[model samples]
Target: MFIEERKFEYWMNRLVSHFETVNRKIDKLSNTENKINDEVLLDNQDLCLLLKVSKRTLQRFRSSGKLPYKRIGKKTYYLESDVHEFIQNGFSKK
Candidate 1:
């Protein structure tokens, strides 16, 4: 069975578009060998490890609004952008 030219082109175009989107996402995830950027989602433990602090310190940061995070169920997540902003703004003890 022969496919119509227009139908073949449409399917090919859609496949190409889907591949392009997936390729873009892959590049975004693995763009750097060593550095993951602001698009990454980080949990509390990752934040504490990155900042070299205890889990309690992270809890205090969240409680005092020194950092911003999202809570889904019992787990929390912070965007790398927010953590970067918090660092750039200089978090200090009162």
Candidate 2:
């Protein structure tokens, strides 16, 4: 069988370039998201969706001091950093 060396090299370079572009975009978004997390407050609905947990669980966390939150008027909000910290602290080596 004959190998098309030039075609192989071209496709491989293209794939690597695509991956690099995707990685750079992801890194940028990650940094921006982290910055937004600490400064922004998330309402109960947003928090629930992000964590994929029910509202009752969130209430329990607040009551138990697992997650810190705030109240402005009748609405409750949580900082993104607090949620991130909560998840990180929960990691266990198994």
lDDT of 2 at 51: 80
Per-residue CA lDDT of model 2 for 1-41, tens digit only, reads 87599988999999999999999999988766312334878
lDDT for each residue of candidate 1 in 1-94, tens digit (9 for 90 to 100): 9999999999999999999999999998876432235377788788888999898988899999999988857988888788999998886654
Cα displacement (angstroms), candidate 2, residue 65, comes to 0.3
lDDT of each: 0.84, 0.80
Stretches of candidate 2 off by over 4 Å are: 1-38, 91-94
Q: What TM-score, over all chains together, does every model reach?
A: 0.56, 0.55
- State the local distance difference test value for candidate 1: 0.84
Segments in model 1 whose C-alpha atoms lie over 4 Å from true places: 1-38
